[model samples]
Target: MNLLLVEDDLDLGNGVRIALANQGMDVVWVRRLDDALRTLDGGTFDMVLLDLGLPDGDGLDLLFRLRRDRQILPVLVLSARDALNDRLRSLDDGADDYLVKPFALAELLSRVRALARRSYGFNDETIRMRGLALHEPTRGVIVDGEPVELSRCEFDLLALLLKRTGRVVTRRVMEEQVLPGGQANGSNSLEVHISNLRKKIGQGYIRTVRGIGYVIDVQSLARSTQK
Candidate 1:
């Protein structure tokens, strides 16, 4: 999952970003609300990890704007305010979940996964499609009942695409989410990873969309093969 982290505290932001990325999730960290808004304007993130206090303004304003604009992306508020009214107001403003400050990273991760599942309409950690079984908790991939080891990038890429199966995923989105520094770094790492994934999981699963991107349209591939 690609996450946009809106926080001002340098230490906490880094810690959260590193922890989330270590768990095979993509993250982009910004310290100010304006930066967060700009990032949101152009980015295709799956969710937002919003801090209630920001350097420029309150994070509640961002949440209010999102709800006002009808952006339904899942948001989990991370705040130091433990007052019942504060939490209630945030939820009422449209946050999917809330996490108080100084919480355990493990618990935060769990909440993130829960929100991800809820927003993506996934009922469990393991996403089963076609013959592939991707177990998120264990970071395990089983193809046709056989375990297939994958690097972190490959695993993240596959999970992102699989979650959106039968739909075209833009190349820009994939590169930013999976590649380093939200870029290709002038290298063909995106293609290389995809090629390696294809070799390991078997072909005909991912198809190049020509000038646009790639897709995992099982039905279309099946139909073309039967022709």
Candidate 2:
């Protein structure tokens, strides 16, 4: 998932970014609310982690502005404020969830996954299509009752495809989700990841639409012929 983290503390931001990246999330850290707002205005993000004690302004004001502008992106407040009133205020101001500082990374990840699933209209962590299964929190993919090992990027690629199963995802669309900032990368990186993913899940799992992009047969790929 693509995430924007707005935290003023450099060390905390770096640590959280690294940890989330290790968990297969593309996280962009912005130290100030203005930078965060600018990034939000520029691109789409799956979620936002806003620290209330920002250097420039209160994070609640940013949250309020996002709501005022009718942005539906989920925001989770991460701050040291643990008082009941503070949590209530944050939620009332449009924060989806609140995490206190010195929090466990695992808990944060779990909450993030929950919010992500909620955003996708899924109440569960496991996503199933045909005979394929993906456990998002654990980053596990299983096909035909056997476990499949996938690299971080491969898993992310597969997750993106599965999320939109049955839809033809164009190269540009996939690149936007898979590549950070939608930046250009080494030639054929998408193709390489797709190729490797197909090898693990079987070639028939992802279909290449000539001169267009790829599609996953959400209902019947498991029964199709593999190249």
Candidate 3:
């Protein structure tokens, strides 16, 4: 998962980023709401871990703007405010979930996973399509009942593709969500990764849509092969 973390607390922010990274998540940390907005505008994130108290302005301001713009990205507010009104207002103002400060990282990760699943129209940790199983909790993939060993990047890339199953995932979207921000490799690099990924999984799993991007259409491909 790719996440945007907006927090000004140095210790807490760094700790959370490290923990999330260790769990196979790509995270971008920004201290202020301005930076958060800038990052949000530029990159695609699976979710946002937002801190209401920010240096430049309140994080709620960002949330409000996102809602006003009709952005449906999942946001989980992390703040020190524990008041009932605060919780109610946050939910009313488009926060998908809320977590108070001094919370366990484990619980936060659970919530993050929950929100991510919801975004993908799934209620479970594992997403399955056409005999391919993506276990989000372990970042594991299984094909034809066999476990497939994948690099972190490969796993993330496959997860993204699986989430969009039959659709053509644009190169720009892949770069933002799969690769590190500002470190998206050249076209040849992504092609090489895709090549290796096909070798591990199956060459029939992915299709390169020249001039557009890549796609995975297992059912469609199966039908075509049968014909």
Best model number under TM-score: 3
Ranking by TM-score: 3, 1, 2
Tens digits of per-residue lDDT for model 3, 41-109: 876666789999888898999999988986667899999999999999999999999999999999998
Better of 1 and 2 by TM-score: 1
Instruction: Assess the local accuracy of residue 226 in candidate 2 as a C-alpha lDDT between 0 and 100.
Output: 35
How do all models score by TM-score? Answer: 0.61, 0.58, 0.63
- Summarize candidate 1's per-residue lDDT along 147-203 as a digit string, tens digits: 999999999899888776655688888988787787655677788888899889887
For each candidate in the order shown, give its overall lDDT on alpha carbons.
Answer: 0.84, 0.81, 0.81
Once superposed on the true structure, which residue ranges of model 1 sit more than 4 Å away at CA?
A: 123-125, 128-227
TM-score of model number 2: 0.58
- Residue 118 CA error for candidate 1 (Å)? 1.8
Best by lDDT: 1
Evaluated at residue 145, the lDDT of candidate 1 is: 92
